[model samples]
Target: MYKVTVYVTYKDSVLDPQGEAVKGAVHRMGYDSVENIRIGKYFEIQVSKDEDDIEQVIEEICDKLLANVVMETYRYDIQEVEI
Candidate 1:
Protein backbone atom coordinates (compact mmCIF):
# COMPACT_ATOMS: atom_id res chain seq x y z
CA MET A 1 0.00 0.00 0.00
CA TYR A 2 0.97 3.60 -0.41
CA LYS A 3 0.15 6.62 1.68
CA VAL A 4 0.05 10.11 0.22
CA THR A 5 0.09 13.32 2.19
CA VAL A 6 -1.02 16.37 0.27
CA TYR A 7 -0.70 19.98 1.34
CA VAL A 8 -2.57 22.67 -0.60
CA THR A 9 -2.09 26.35 0.04
CA TYR A 10 -2.51 29.70 -1.62
CA LYS A 11 0.27 30.95 -3.78
CA ASP A 12 2.63 33.44 -2.15
CA SER A 13 1.34 36.21 -4.33
CA VAL A 14 -2.23 35.75 -3.13
CA LEU A 15 -3.61 37.29 0.00
CA ASP A 16 -4.80 34.91 2.75
CA PRO A 17 -7.68 36.67 4.44
CA GLN A 18 -8.53 33.77 6.74
CA GLY A 19 -5.00 33.51 7.97
CA GLU A 20 -4.84 37.25 8.48
CA ALA A 21 -8.04 37.15 10.52
CA VAL A 22 -6.66 34.42 12.70
CA LYS A 23 -3.48 36.33 13.19
CA GLY A 24 -5.45 39.41 14.17
CA ALA A 25 -7.37 37.37 16.71
CA VAL A 26 -4.17 35.97 18.09
CA HIS A 27 -2.74 39.44 18.43
CA ARG A 28 -5.82 40.54 20.30
CA MET A 29 -5.31 37.56 22.62
CA GLY A 30 -1.84 38.94 23.53
CA TYR A 31 0.28 36.87 21.17
CA ASP A 32 2.39 39.65 19.75
CA SER A 33 5.18 37.36 18.62
CA VAL A 34 2.98 35.84 15.94
CA GLU A 35 4.30 37.34 12.73
CA ASN A 36 2.37 35.68 9.93
CA ILE A 37 -0.04 32.83 9.31
CA ARG A 38 -1.25 30.97 6.25
CA ILE A 39 -4.18 28.61 5.96
CA GLY A 40 -3.90 25.40 3.98
CA LYS A 41 -5.61 22.09 3.30
CA TYR A 42 -4.26 18.68 4.12
CA PHE A 43 -5.33 15.41 2.57
CA GLU A 44 -4.28 11.89 3.29
CA ILE A 45 -4.82 9.38 0.53
CA GLN A 46 -4.29 5.64 0.39
CA VAL A 47 -3.60 3.78 -2.80
CA SER A 48 -3.18 0.11 -3.59
CA LYS A 49 0.29 -1.08 -4.49
CA ASP A 50 -1.07 -2.44 -7.75
CA GLU A 51 -1.44 1.04 -9.17
CA ASP A 52 1.12 2.09 -11.73
CA ASP A 53 2.68 5.57 -11.88
CA ILE A 54 1.67 6.69 -8.44
CA GLU A 55 3.38 10.05 -8.87
CA GLN A 56 1.48 10.80 -12.03
CA VAL A 57 -1.78 9.85 -10.40
CA ILE A 58 -1.12 12.12 -7.46
CA GLU A 59 -0.10 15.01 -9.68
CA GLU A 60 -3.24 14.74 -11.75
CA ILE A 61 -5.44 14.52 -8.69
CA CYS A 62 -3.87 17.62 -7.18
CA ASP A 63 -3.91 19.63 -10.36
CA LYS A 64 -7.45 18.72 -11.34
CA LEU A 65 -9.33 18.50 -8.07
CA LEU A 66 -7.46 19.37 -4.92
CA ALA A 67 -6.01 22.75 -5.86
CA ASN A 68 -6.78 25.74 -8.04
CA VAL A 69 -3.83 26.13 -10.34
CA VAL A 70 -4.26 29.89 -10.65
CA MET A 71 -4.31 30.80 -6.99
CA GLU A 72 -3.05 27.78 -5.09
CA THR A 73 -0.14 25.35 -5.15
CA TYR A 74 0.34 21.90 -3.72
CA ARG A 75 3.02 19.50 -2.61
CA TYR A 76 2.82 15.80 -1.79
CA ASP A 77 4.79 13.12 -0.06
CA ILE A 78 4.44 9.41 -0.86
CA GLN A 79 5.34 6.67 1.55
CA GLU A 80 5.12 2.92 1.32
CA VAL A 81 2.83 1.38 3.90
CA GLU A 82 2.65 -2.18 5.13
CA ILE A 83 -1.11 -2.14 5.50
Candidate 2:
Protein backbone atom coordinates (compact mmCIF):
# COMPACT_ATOMS: atom_id res chain seq x y z
CA MET A 1 0.00 0.00 0.00
CA TYR A 2 0.96 3.58 -0.40
CA LYS A 3 0.08 6.68 1.59
CA VAL A 4 0.03 10.06 -0.06
CA THR A 5 -0.17 13.46 1.58
CA VAL A 6 -1.16 16.35 -0.64
CA TYR A 7 -0.94 20.01 0.27
CA VAL A 8 -2.67 22.62 -1.84
CA THR A 9 -2.23 26.35 -1.48
CA TYR A 10 -2.64 29.58 -3.37
CA LYS A 11 0.20 30.83 -5.51
CA ASP A 12 2.41 33.48 -3.96
CA SER A 13 0.94 36.06 -6.27
CA VAL A 14 -2.58 35.31 -5.09
CA LEU A 15 -4.06 37.19 -2.17
CA ASP A 16 -5.33 35.21 0.82
CA PRO A 17 -8.18 37.18 2.25
CA GLN A 18 -9.12 34.55 4.82
CA GLY A 19 -5.59 34.40 6.11
CA GLU A 20 -5.44 38.15 6.30
CA ALA A 21 -8.65 38.26 8.25
CA VAL A 22 -7.32 35.76 10.72
CA LYS A 23 -4.14 37.70 11.09
CA GLY A 24 -6.12 40.83 11.77
CA ALA A 25 -8.09 39.03 14.43
CA VAL A 26 -4.91 37.75 15.98
CA HIS A 27 -3.55 41.25 16.15
CA ARG A 28 -6.72 42.41 17.86
CA MET A 29 -6.22 39.64 20.40
CA GLY A 30 -2.78 41.12 21.23
CA TYR A 31 -0.52 38.86 19.16
CA ASP A 32 1.36 41.72 17.60
CA SER A 33 4.31 39.68 16.40
CA VAL A 34 2.23 37.90 13.76
CA GLU A 35 3.51 38.95 10.34
CA ASN A 36 1.74 36.91 7.68
CA ILE A 37 -0.52 33.93 7.23
CA ARG A 38 -1.76 31.76 4.39
CA ILE A 39 -4.56 29.23 4.17
CA GLY A 40 -4.22 25.85 2.46
CA LYS A 41 -5.82 22.46 1.99
CA TYR A 42 -4.53 19.05 2.94
CA PHE A 43 -5.54 15.68 1.53
CA GLU A 44 -4.62 12.13 2.43
CA ILE A 45 -4.99 9.36 -0.13
CA GLN A 46 -4.30 5.65 -0.01
CA VAL A 47 -3.37 3.67 -3.11
CA SER A 48 -3.25 -0.06 -3.44
CA LYS A 49 -0.01 -1.83 -4.11
CA ASP A 50 -1.33 -3.04 -7.46
CA GLU A 51 -1.46 0.47 -8.83
CA ASP A 52 1.18 1.37 -11.40
CA ASP A 53 2.91 4.70 -11.99
CA ILE A 54 2.03 6.25 -8.66
CA GLU A 55 3.76 9.51 -9.53
CA GLN A 56 1.78 9.91 -12.72
CA VAL A 57 -1.45 9.12 -10.93
CA ILE A 58 -0.74 11.67 -8.22
CA GLU A 59 0.23 14.32 -10.77
CA GLU A 60 -2.91 13.79 -12.77
CA ILE A 61 -5.09 13.98 -9.68
CA CYS A 62 -3.40 17.11 -8.43
CA ASP A 63 -3.36 18.88 -11.76
CA LYS A 64 -6.91 18.01 -12.73
CA LEU A 65 -8.77 18.14 -9.42
CA LEU A 66 -6.97 19.14 -6.25
CA ALA A 67 -5.47 22.47 -7.33
CA ASN A 68 -6.33 25.39 -9.54
CA VAL A 69 -3.49 25.63 -12.02
CA VAL A 70 -4.05 29.33 -12.64
CA MET A 71 -4.12 30.44 -9.01
CA GLU A 72 -2.91 27.62 -6.77
CA THR A 73 -0.04 25.11 -6.50
CA TYR A 74 0.38 21.72 -4.87
CA ARG A 75 2.93 19.25 -3.59
CA TYR A 76 2.72 15.70 -2.25
CA ASP A 77 4.61 13.09 -0.28
CA ILE A 78 4.30 9.36 -0.92
CA GLN A 79 5.26 6.60 1.42
CA GLU A 80 5.04 2.82 1.29
CA VAL A 81 2.90 1.21 3.96
CA GLU A 82 1.93 -2.31 4.96
CA ILE A 83 -1.75 -1.51 4.86
Candidate 3:
Protein backbone atom coordinates (compact mmCIF):
# COMPACT_ATOMS: atom_id res chain seq x y z
CA MET A 1 0.00 0.00 0.00
CA TYR A 2 1.04 3.57 -0.60
CA LYS A 3 0.03 6.81 1.07
CA VAL A 4 0.07 10.14 -0.74
CA THR A 5 -0.08 13.56 0.88
CA VAL A 6 -0.81 16.73 -1.06
CA TYR A 7 -0.51 20.35 -0.04
CA VAL A 8 -2.12 23.13 -2.03
CA THR A 9 -1.72 26.82 -1.37
CA TYR A 10 -2.16 30.17 -3.01
CA LYS A 11 0.82 31.55 -4.86
CA ASP A 12 2.81 34.28 -3.20
CA SER A 13 1.49 36.92 -5.54
CA VAL A 14 -2.10 36.03 -4.75
CA LEU A 15 -3.92 37.58 -1.83
CA ASP A 16 -5.20 35.33 0.95
CA PRO A 17 -8.32 36.84 2.49
CA GLN A 18 -8.90 34.06 4.99
CA GLY A 19 -5.35 34.27 6.24
CA GLU A 20 -5.62 38.02 6.55
CA ALA A 21 -8.80 37.67 8.56
CA VAL A 22 -7.14 35.28 10.95
CA LYS A 23 -4.20 37.62 11.32
CA GLY A 24 -6.49 40.48 12.17
CA ALA A 25 -8.26 38.34 14.74
CA VAL A 26 -4.97 37.41 16.28
CA HIS A 27 -4.00 41.04 16.55
CA ARG A 28 -7.33 41.91 18.16
CA MET A 29 -6.66 39.19 20.74
CA GLY A 30 -3.52 41.06 21.86
CA TYR A 31 -1.05 39.08 19.82
CA ASP A 32 0.94 41.85 18.20
CA SER A 33 4.00 39.82 17.33
CA VAL A 34 2.19 37.88 14.66
CA GLU A 35 3.29 38.39 11.11
CA ASN A 36 1.74 37.63 7.76
CA ILE A 37 -0.12 34.39 7.35
CA ARG A 38 -1.25 32.17 4.49
CA ILE A 39 -3.84 29.43 4.25
CA GLY A 40 -3.52 26.17 2.39
CA LYS A 41 -5.27 22.89 1.72
CA TYR A 42 -4.18 19.34 2.34
CA PHE A 43 -5.28 16.02 0.96
CA GLU A 44 -4.45 12.42 1.74
CA ILE A 45 -4.90 9.54 -0.64
CA GLN A 46 -4.31 5.84 -0.39
CA VAL A 47 -3.51 3.74 -3.42
CA SER A 48 -3.88 0.02 -3.18
CA LYS A 49 -1.95 -0.78 -6.31
CA ASP A 50 1.57 -2.15 -6.12
CA GLU A 51 2.69 -0.85 -9.48
CA ASP A 52 5.91 1.09 -9.72
CA ASP A 53 4.27 3.90 -11.71
CA ILE A 54 1.73 4.74 -9.05
CA GLU A 55 3.54 7.84 -8.01
CA GLN A 56 3.59 9.13 -11.54
CA VAL A 57 -0.10 8.45 -11.91
CA ILE A 58 -0.87 10.34 -8.70
CA GLU A 59 1.19 13.31 -9.85
CA GLU A 60 -0.71 13.39 -13.09
CA ILE A 61 -3.96 13.41 -11.19
CA CYS A 62 -2.81 16.28 -9.01
CA ASP A 63 -1.77 18.33 -11.99
CA LYS A 64 -4.83 17.64 -14.05
CA LEU A 65 -7.78 17.38 -11.66
CA LEU A 66 -6.76 17.85 -8.04
CA ALA A 67 -5.03 21.21 -8.18
CA ASN A 68 -5.35 24.41 -10.14
CA VAL A 69 -2.01 25.51 -11.53
CA VAL A 70 -2.99 29.10 -12.32
CA MET A 71 -3.52 30.53 -8.82
CA GLU A 72 -2.39 27.70 -6.55
CA THR A 73 0.81 25.71 -6.06
CA TYR A 74 0.75 22.05 -5.13
CA ARG A 75 3.26 19.53 -3.81
CA TYR A 76 2.91 15.86 -2.98
CA ASP A 77 4.81 13.07 -1.28
CA ILE A 78 4.28 9.33 -1.53
CA GLN A 79 5.44 6.67 0.89
CA GLU A 80 5.10 2.94 1.00
CA VAL A 81 3.22 1.59 4.00
CA GLU A 82 3.47 -1.80 5.61
CA ILE A 83 0.34 -3.79 6.33
Q: TM-score winner among the candidates?
A: 1
List candidate 2 segments past 4 Å from native: none
39-78, model 1: which lDDT tens digit per residue?
A: 9999999999999999999999999999999999999999
Candidate 1 regions exceeding 4 Å error are none
Alpha carbon deviation, residue 51, candidate 2 (Å): 1.6
Between candidates 1 and 3, the one scoring higher on TM-score is 1
Q: Please, what is the TM-score per model?
A: 0.97, 0.96, 0.88
lDDT of each: 0.98, 0.95, 0.89
lDDT of 2 by residue, 1-83 (tens): 99999999999999999999999999999999999989999999999988999999999999999999899999999999984
Stronger candidate by lDDT (2 vs 3): 2
Residue pair clashes in candidate 1:
none
lDDT of 3 by residue, 1-83 (tens): 98889999999999999999999999999999999989999999898866779878887888898878888899888888987
Model 2, TM vs. native: 0.96
Error of 3 at 2 (Å): 0.7
